[model samples]
Target chain A: MALTFKPLADRVVIEPVAAETKTASGIYIPDSAKEKPQQGKVIAVGKGTKEHDMTVAEGDMVLYGKFSGTELKLDGKDYLIMRETEILGIL
Target chain B: MALTFKPLADRVVIEPVAAETKTASGIYIPDSAKEKPQQGKVIAVGKGTKEHDMTVAEGDMVLYGKFSGTELKLDGKDYLIMRETEILGIL
Candidate 1:
């Protein structure tokens, strides 16, 4: 399913990758113990403002966070990703 | 305990308010179904960059996120929050 909000100029929509549960000892780590990934998938993209060297687009997964970006929930599923500037790198 | 990294300047350290489990129906919401908070505390801050309007500082809980910021794990505990610019607002 697609998000209703389309990221605007230089922004991108992302769905962060799921976190892992197993610890190094093979113990199941609860969500309380895991850090969110600083990465995600680019769902929609705004034509980057022609201000800097922009290099991301729709469908491109990226690494971000200076850390930056907004979080959004839609259709009962949670997804994120924000301004391309918020994106630290393209993965 | 204070984070080892002291936010250099405008940044403030924050411990995000934990998320609530259970829907309105009181059904437990699994970690897999939850979104990480797009907010955090200022751990270490660089003195606010003088070029723009610097409106944040250490210990001042701010509402940030374009949404933006980084995630870092220290001593096995996870913490987040980034530049004042990344912070959308002060709480």
Candidate 2:
């Protein structure tokens, strides 16, 4: 879904992949025990500075650092705002 | 000074610039009140993954986010380990 947010300067808005609700053994994972997901889909990207090139594009799936990015809630949906460098690999 | 630590894959080692001890208006800033410095000089860098290009090099002064990176101490000096993407700009 598209929104009205616009990031600035190599920053990106990412929608994280949801954590697994159940294990392969059919045990329900409690919310407190759910791991933070490290994968996401790029939603928005900022224009890169003159010194740096922006390579990530919208709709790209990416891997990021475990603690990278700031969490935000927009329109009741969660998103992360991080520099493009915080992305480890483009999947 | 050189060290033996080598970072892995898109990570970088940085020596943070010292926080200002005094304000420009002649007010002495105590250690507890010192702001986290957001600038540093790159000391080491990891080889980037095949998808991400490694563009930063040692000795390049850079600006980073206030809360970015992990703190470490080597040879009695402090350093930070962060991905190259945590860097906001190269100075």
Candidate 3:
């Protein structure tokens, strides 16, 4: 529960909840896998830009496209959150 | 290899490559199953605007955050491609 975002304009900042490599299911694939699964926790959300209005909020777990978001480094780790358009859905 | 994009000044259109339910792997979970994987193909790309530039081209398989990109419905199909920032990494 450690997340906060300061979005500029219509860009929403989200702190992706890191997916557990090994869930209760079984051993999760390594990052080396070509077709890997993406998981994350949301931290910050941006205001809607242009014609897009945001429906997601902070602290909401979400799932987005693997190819979405600009890779960002915060607090010496990885985190990503872009425009409301970039976000897919809340988990 | 089937993609065409008509981005509107700073936006890109992508045709998500639908992920195979049953791959060379084992049984793929049903959509009703939580923690599902998202897959799509790139179709269109928008021209750069403001402070962003066009990087990812059409037909390039990409991975994004689950909460990334605005969900769009076009021609009875679903697709999304925003700024280069919206795109996480090329797959």
Writing each residue's lDDT as its tens digit, candidate 2 over B1-91 gives 6778999998999998654432222222123423222556799999887755676789876556678999999899999999877775453
Give TM per candidate. Answer: 0.39, 0.45, 0.40
Candidate 2 per-residue lDDT, tens place, A1-91, comes to 4555556467888998754444333433234553433777788887775567888999887768768887644444667778898898776
Better of 1 and 2 by DockQ: 1
True contacts kept of 2: 0.00
- What is the docking quality class of candidate 3? incorrect
DockQ of each: 0.04, 0.03, 0.04
Arrange candidates by TM-score, highest first: which order? Answer: 2, 3, 1
The pairs that clash in candidate 2 are: A85-B85
Tens-digit per-residue lDDT, A12-55, candidate 3: 56555544433332323345434332445567766667655556
Model 1: CA > 4 A from native: A21-37, B1-91
How do the residues A1-91 of candidate 1 rate in per-residue lDDT, one tens digit apiece? 5434434345566777544434333433234543433656677665444464457766775655524665554335556646677776665
Question: What local lDDT does model 1 show for residue A18?
Answer: 41
| Candidate 1 backbone overlaps, count | 29
